[model samples]
Target chain A: EAGVAQSPRYKIIEKRQSVAFWCNPISGHATLYWYQQILGQGPKLLIQFQNNGVVDDSQLPKDRFSAERLKGVDSTLKIQPAKLEDSAVYLCASSLGGTTVRETQYFGPGTRLLVL
Target chain B: DQQVKQNSPSLSVQEGRISILNCDYTNSMFDYFLWYKKYPAEGPTFLISISSIKDKNEDGRFTVFLNKSAKHLSLHIVPSQPGDSAVYFCAASDITSNTGKLIFGQGTTLQVKP
Candidate 1:
């Protein structure tokens, strides 16, 4: 079975510029997530989508970051007016959406973004 | 507050030896724990996991041990190989949330020498 897929494995932008990352979840998977990982830290969840609906986005920077899962299959995460500190790897993951919360999430290759 | 932490930033071991990675959590609500291995320039892949109710769970050469009373967990890779070298992260989740949200640690870099 194919795993989660992401586009533009690497990206570079200037400060204050905008950048976007795309993610396509595994087939039949209904839950998607976006996370940010700094150079030495583990991935921090930015947002979560459960079938075209936002489940959690408390950590996302509302003033500069936004994400959407329109059809519940693929999702996009955008950051406007990027800052130098925003340079990090953005990871996308998915899991079967069901009442069981212990399901393992499959991850993509991730998009490494750098804001100069 | 940092709920999960991997105190050791890195560890080195000889091939055919044992590699042990440790993690600690401050949240008592976390009932499920997982370990993920990540290579450079790649995303993390699920390794082994242990629920709060169980103290140990083993998969092939990897084993996860959970100590709920101490809020600590560990990953053991026996007969470690060079292929096992990578950054290892431990994640925890409170299944009650129903959203499957995971809180990850800072991660430990493991180097296995041939």
Candidate 2:
């Protein structure tokens, strides 16, 4: 079976510029998530989507970051006025069902973003 | 507050020796824990998991042990192989919250020498 898919494996942008990343989750998966991984650090959850609805986004920076899932399959995460601190790898993951903590999540190759 | 922590930044072991990675969590509410393996330029992959009710869970040559009272966990890989060299992350979840959210540790890089 195919795993989660993400676009633009790498990206570079100047500070204050805007950037967007895309993600396509595994087939039939009911939950999708976006995470940020700074160098030398483990991934941190940014937002979660169950179908077309938002499940959790408490860590998302509302002033600079936003996300949406359309048709409950594809998702996009955007950051405006990117800062140097925002440089990190963006990862997308999916699970069959997110109702339980036991559900294992599969991840994509991830998009590495750098802000100059 | 950093709830989950992997204190060891790195570890090295012989190919035929055992590799043990340690993790500690401050939240007692976390009832489920997991380990993930990651290679350069790739996202983390699920390795093994253990529930609070079980002290140990093993798969193949990998084993996970949870110490609820101590709020600590460890992953053991026996007869480690070169291919096992990667960053290992420990994650925990509070199932009672019903959020399905996972808190991850900083990760430890393990290297197996031939």
Candidate 3:
């Protein structure tokens, strides 16, 4: 089985500009997540999608950040009017969500976004 | 709130020694704990994990020890090699019970010398 896939291994954008990152979850995976990792800090969860529905997005900045998983297989995270503080690596992960401890998540190669 | 923390920012060990990485959590609701390894420009790769009920879980040369009373956990890589050098992150999740959110810690960078 293939692993989770993400696009644009690296991204550099100017402040106040817009940027988007895409993620394709593993086959048959039902849960997808987006996280942001800043230098010297742990990853912060941005949003989560269970199938085509949003599970949790409380941490996402609605004023500038938005994400969508239309068909539930692939997802997109967009940041409009990016800020310099938004310069960080965006990671995507997928898991077979259920009531089981065996459901492990697989992560993809993150998109490193640097807002100048 | 910062629920998880890895106090050590970096560790150095010679090859063939035991590499121990530690983590602490403040949340009592976390039932499952996982460790992930990450290289530069890549997302974290799943490593060994231990549930709250179990104190220890071993996989090959990797082992995870959980201390629920102290709310601490550790990852042990025996006979560490150069290939084991990477940033290791400790994460806790409320799986199979409540919310499925993973709270991660600031990664610890391990450098194994040949």
Q: Give TM-scores for every candidate, taking all chains together and pairing residue i with residue i.
A: 0.98, 0.98, 0.96
Candidate 2 clash pair list:
none
**Model 2 stretches with alpha carbons more than 4 Å out:** none
- lDDT for each residue of candidate 1 in B27-81, tens digit (9 for 90 to 100): 9999999999999878899998888889999999999999999999999999899
DockQ of candidate 2 (2 decimals): 0.81
Q: Which candidate has the highest DockQ of all? A: 1
* Candidates 2 and 3, the one with greater TM-score: 2
lDDT of 2 by residue, B52-105 (tens): 999999999999999898999999999899999999999999867666889999
For candidate 2, give the lDDT of residue B36.
98
lDDT of each: 0.94, 0.94, 0.92
What's the TM-score of chain A alone for every prediction? 0.98, 0.96, 0.96
Clashes of 1: 0
- Give candidate 1's TM-score: 0.98
User: What local lDDT score does residue A23 receive in model 2, on the 0 to 100 scale?
Assistant: 97
How high is the TM-score of chain A in model 1? 0.98
Worst 10 residues of 1 chain A by lDDT: A97-106
Model 3's i-RMS, to one decimal, reads 1.7
